[model samples]
Target: MIFTTKWYETVEPAGCKQRQSIVKALGLALGLLFSGHALSQNLVTNPGFENGASGWNTSGTTSAQIIESSGRSGNRLTHWSADSSYTVSTYQTITGLTPGTYRLSAYTIGGNTDDATLFASNCGNQNSQTAIPAAAWGNWTQVVLDNIQVTGSSCTIGIYTQNSDWTSIDDVNFELQSPPPGSGNDTAVEILAGKGFNYARIRLLVTPPDSYALHQDLDYVIAMAKEAKANNMNILLDIFYSNWWADPGQNWAPAEWFNQDVNTLENTVYNYTRDVLNQMAAEGVLPNMVQIGNEVNPGMLWNLGNISDNGWGNFVRFTNSGYDAVKSVSNNIPVIIHYAGVGSSATSWYASYTNNGGKMDAIGLSFYEMWHGTINDATTTISSLHSYFNVPVYMVETAAYWTSSDAGSTTSYPQTKQGQYDYLFDLTNAVKNINGFAGLFYWGATWTQSNNWLNAPDWQDDDAATRSLFDSNAQVNPAASAIVDAGGLSIRGVDISEAHYIESNGVEYLDN
Candidate 1:
């Protein structure tokens, strides 16, 4: 009867609704995964941009720069005009090339308005367009310059400010390619495996087993856990004190405990949490991460500590006690505090809560397109929030499609594939201050049809919905692909940054 017991791991008849549902969903996902495309390691490396070569600028260049005799420890030490800038002093050499069709480009960073140019021919054959300005800090940004002909052996290449002023230049590179390529999955866990995703965030509904009123969410958890282990995943069990949903508003105590005093009930929460965690401590198993309560903004475990006057005290007691119990059982696991808020203003939110002494290991935010607004909106919010909290923020729970493609009268962006791509990028970009960022977790890898628990007619899931990286039909959506495929979700986990991530070459991967 215990959750980790695997008691229900039987290979039951394929005809059962539950089993059938899983198989169908898994198959659809597989079909879509295999059908997904892949990205090529399209990189550009410049042969120059080092040691201020002799014939570099005078050969044909723009100058508004000087060089620094000393460089940074982990970075290239170089300078342009003015005190120092990435733009301004890009040595310019213009070349002429015969008429032809081709894609040309360079990856740069730093100069927000710097525009490096790749020339066509020496007659200044009129083929110099603005290369997107880039300023290198401690990272990389690849910029593409498309369609140009190499009529002569070489023409001219120049790096300069957007307006031909002073700027800085750090690491520079060049590359020629048709386009970038991307990959797909062929089975359950296959694609996710490919994406270097090595963990899963699962939710558990802690209920007395004898209570038939409990959510079968436990059933879903076990099913997911087995699959997760099979995929070599580390789990983050989000245990909600409620039999169903638990949040600041309704941290419903178990039905049996309704009559119990707040003190006794609070102890019950601690004891029950410890009991559950202890039971799950087999095979080096215990949640790698656990969230004590869902969203405790207004506070949780109501009644005696109903957030009246000494609400903070009560909340602290409940949480600290819960924390003590968890630590007593397993001292190493990290606990997260989650919340639902608009990304538009993370400062005003966390400044008010976290700054006020709310105990939490990490700050978690749920940025849903339906609620928090655009991808850009969410991103800007995170950027500001990070500065204020000086703590990490996880794009904890987010989903795009309200319904499978109905694109409700909602204001969600794109409402299609392009929209999905932009939304994901927006999130990643929003958390540019990456080191402290954790990861983004999609709320539902769920699909609904007819009138089941998951089915919500009002919830339109445009194939564009960036929920599970795959749709209800099991097709690979852009979100999942973009995650590991982009650059390994640095904000998530390090495991996602390796080659042969989830799986490779017709075999599964080990939990590295």
Candidate 2:
């Protein structure tokens, strides 16, 4: 008998329950889609802040001022300008709500604030507050805070800031989530398995105090890998090799590796990589493949390891150190070098790396349709890379919007749900048509509305990947079905099912 035990992924709180509950609600809704009825009514009055903050209780030295027609949805929004360096907060009591699960959300933009939070708390008791840190500057962002448990008939929803300046909020929403019958049968990993996705790619940071706080630490990545193993999913461990998000723009060495010479830095990479693999192995969730670094187009480790600033020799040495560390753990585990860009750009980057003796089992590319040109351009680039490197090429990062009604996307594909479905559907075919093509992995899996929620402080990319498998409400979207429609493609000896259903403790069971 194939016992398919349901496994749940636990989300560690960085600040509030937004990360934990929103993701859980979406996964739960994935199985309840066909049966349950959601009785949703926007409980908060003047949710869009269009009524000039009327119905809200404002405190502190600051005021909740209303600005006409300057919101996320192009409607009237409330602006709180902190000209003075003082603390201020605003709230509204939402009454007549039944004791049940609820989600409170708002769109906010903050600048030069010590800290800003959007929360939903019990009227009498502030201890049960479900909140998230808000900081979305330069553009508007939709902040969806789900999985709020209301034990009473009334809850206080509001925004609070301390020594903050220039923050605006709009589209405040608080709604009850009514679950359909016979839910909880499938988890997020199972839903992905059903949709022909077997690989779980997790990103790891050496010391991510600046990003994810306690969220993306080593223990968290190990927990994630163990959960993926329980679901019989393939693991692709992506090492950032930095203290924060490791891209060409913001890749910095961890504090321990700071001021180290080139040789010392190389040794640090080697030791860190080996220790990570060893830690993962101890948890019984060793990765099948490991990524050396993330999107090292300009180079990694900033001045010391960056190829552009230092030279090709230093960059190659750093990469080879990581590669050797992976092999030291187990020769069977494959190493991948990832880069962002397509066509001649990709070719030129690979040439520099390989010419300097960079060794990688496979090549990964970030082929966002909007950023990397059209599908034709991707096809040409992939073909050229394979011909030159003679190695398997795959899309390590790719995504589109499910609906253009929110954030406007310009990939020649319509912003509608159908457009999202068709984008991945066609992109899958394009990859499969090429010789030596490996596979594709969506960039941000749980992304729904705004990509601004991804990182904070600097908050780089503000893409609302509405094309995600789930919508802003955490319910299954049409783009998810599109992935299922693509089914599975064979790469080398590994098929989608095999990838997801690898042997666990000397037993392999094909789920469904």
Candidate 3:
């Protein structure tokens, strides 16, 4: 069968039962081209650019085509597919139809093994989209969304497939008997961040068995990326080279690569990094910034981990390999070198990596104070490194807990509320003092936990309450609120004169 990545068609269902009603409606209002037409009640003539909700959807977050404003060029439909596992795309959702009219309609091209189902239902109700064969997979036909009623904000949109092949969706959008205002534009990120949160981080996974920090949880990795992207949040994707998960303490090799030679292993590592990077680029899911290695207190790829003279060569090759692999996909994606902070291990690792010509876009560190050392010591070391390394530094992983009993005790530092508050305030302040420092990343917010998920009947609290910026149920904690709202107390040596402003609006012109 032939595969197509793109196709644009004027796909409107052709039928007798619907034409008369549409004609009646059209007669009442002056007819105009969809894109240009703007009725007093309806904003845009064609709100659903796809023209049909075929092979795609606009309901729920996951397993649906994403709807985002294409910058300023109106709205857009983005699909982040890593490979053949996913296909089909549309940016259309239908609602507010009359009692007699169905909620969804679509025109599709044939090539499908079975009839393409157009699934839909009224909003606020159970969503179901069942398709009527318009055309085959290679041919064009009109598909009507049935079992739907026009109701408030509720709309059903999705796809039903019988053949298990990559699906293709094109020009699929809404078919409202009468469309609404230009369409309210709001991003999930703006919505969430408005509620609080300034930065978002997504974890990217390598192959299985040797997974990086994700521990081979590729599904969660994808889910997290989708969630952050949908929220329109800035992302810092953390990458680990191992197939499973790897950090300073554990960097287990995948069972497959166990027997491979060091040279072959290095190449394997580079390829894995590059392949995932390329996949992310294609999906447009690549983070604003990418961290090549996580908590490399010892080193990454093992081949370069702990030899004095051999440190530079192995470190250089390993880092450069990952670096080159990423640059090969998109050079603009900044690469960060992450280390453990407070403790001397991370600092020593950085000394080795950078000395061996391992280029770093950003110098990142993780410090828990309890695990590493005193907040003052960690922040001071970070500040000194900024001046010495001539590179900007940031607290990549640092948290000021809020009444979390599970958190390790910092007896000398005190575990009271005020102490927790003081720790965060001081630590953040120190980050502010570093010259090249960007900002602090407080590991972050917890949405829903194991105890209180929608399906878990026994899940009582629902608020997992680990290291959440927000409380158990997503309520803003004092620490997070204090930082975003008050800007917290001052850092000893921190100079945020540059951060005070937007800093070039995050854009710069090239001389060349």
Best by TM-score: 2
Residue 138 displacement (Å), model 1 = 83
Candidate 1, which ten residues in sequence have the lowest lDDT sum? 1-10
How do the candidates rank by TM-score, highest first? 2, 3, 1
Overall local distance difference test of candidate 3: 0.47
TM-scores for every candidate against the unseen true structure: 0.52, 0.59, 0.54
Q: Counting only residues 3 or more apart in sequence or on different chains, how many pairs clash (N, Cα, C under 3 Å) in candidate 1? A: 59
Worst 10 residues of 2 by lDDT: 497-506
Model 1 vs. true fold: TM = 0.52
Clashes in candidate 2: how many? Answer: 5
Model 1: CA > 4 A from native: 1-191, 208-223, 247-249, 304-310, 343-357, 402-409, 448-468, 491-512
**Top candidate when judged by lDDT against the true structure:** 2
Per candidate, the number of residue pairs that clash is 59, 5, 44
Q: Where is model 2 more than 4 Å wrong at Cα?
A: 1-186, 210-214, 405-408, 449-467, 491-512
Displacement of the residue 121 alpha carbon in candidate 2, Å: 24
